[model samples]
Target chain A: MRHISHTDINYADLFADFRDPNSGAVVMFSGEVRDNNKGKAVTHLEYEAYEPMAEKMIDEILNAALEKWPLNKAICVHRVGPIDVCGCAVVVITSSAHRAAAYEANRYIIDRVKYEAPIWKHEFFTDGTSEWGQNCDCSSPSHPHHHEHKHHHAE
Target chain B: METTIQVTCFAGLRKFFNCPLTINLKLPTAYEDVLLEMKKVNPEASEILDSCRIAVCESFVPRTALMTSDEPLFIIPPSSGG
Candidate 1:
């Protein structure tokens, strides 16, 4: 029933909201924080978001996922705040009559969510270096924001 | 009528814009029009002027989306977070 939560999402309760006898499979995927950042010691992560807009974009993706897949239950959870290594950063759960829908819808949700979601995270390195990951693929050449034919700067 | 917008920037974006996390604007006009007007308030707003993605009421909307919708629009900078 919960679409998004700023606090640590109770992922178990979230998936239970859609559990039904007819649903044969429930697949849950969690992306956790890793302590190693390409051989460098990783510290913690700090995430931020344009809350209102991020929520709006999430609903659109949810609607599209519902239409494209035969999923009876879907839950997407993204954490915004500081998190230590090995903590759950993102969670996606889906239920269907078969494993295929669960697998496909889960994949679709993860990929699309990563590319379209408006959340940002700053990776703190043990050596005092920090880097940010781009949340959207809007910079892609095929993006609608791109000029139809001209290959100009991707703002 | 005046409306407010909250923006959160990431990555190198913070280096360009000072870190307060959010900027509140009260503009007596439409969403698209307000964006143009913002520059007057802070010349630095140009960093997000035309290229930023805007979300209104829990949904990302086109720049052409009307400002007179049922809910006030919220402006967001390009997302550079994972």
Candidate 2:
């Protein structure tokens, strides 16, 4: 299932649930909230999404991944709302009969989710300052300063 | 009869239009018209909205699309979530 959650993601539950007798490899990826960004001390992050569309898009990404890879199971969960430093923000799990498919599919799913999902993040710094993230693919191409700003490609 | 469309903003626009969480637009509206309204009400938001992407009925659409009152409209700022 693809989900946008407010609570922390449970790694143990995800790993256990993704297990399959027919699959020999299982790959899991987690995105964590870091304490520093662009030289500023980040205190926390706030995430938001157009819920219905976000979930639907995630399902589409998974479907694409399944078509491209021989997969046994796959699931992704992302968090919305405030997340503290070192906290988990998103998790992806993929299981396949071979390690290569599992690894490649895992990477494909996360990349599509970050680039295509409707979710957005706003960061709060320790100095009582906050800024909206502007690294999405949806940013206007006509803006003069748009290209000058560096984008944060989700890693 | 007059028609009003409800537009919801998230992330950056949320902080700008958070008091109501949603803004109303008159019928016979296009994406550009909405941006103009934002400029009139909050100039700062207009700057941000200028670079934002818009969605109608939960699907991303071009700024030139004409919108009616019954469909859901969303103003999306550049996303950063992973």
Q: Best-fitting candidate, measured by DockQ? A: 2
- Give me the chain B TM-score of candidate 2: 0.78
Note the DockQ of each predicted structure: 0.37, 0.52
What level of docking quality does candidate 2 show? Answer: medium
lDDT per model, in order? Answer: 0.65, 0.77
> Which residue ranges in model 1 land beyond 4 Å of their true spot?
A16-18, A135-155, B1-12, B19-52, B55-82
Taking the tens digit of each residue's C-alpha lDDT, what string does model 2 give over A1-155? 65899888888888998777899999999998989998999999988888998998788778888998999988889999999998888898999999999999998887777766788878999999998775545345743342222332223
Q: Write the residue-wise lDDT of candidate 1 on A1-155 in tens digits.
A: 34445677666777777689989999988878889776888899877776665666667667777888898878777888988998777788888899998898887776766666677778899999987754444446754442111121234
User: By how many angstroms RMSD does model 2 differ from the true structure?
Assistant: 5.4
lDDT of 2 at A9: 84
**lDDT at residue A68 of model 2 (Cα atoms):** 89
For model 2 the local lDDT of residue B28 reads: 69
Query: Positional deviation of B62 in candidate 1, in angstroms?
Result: 5.2
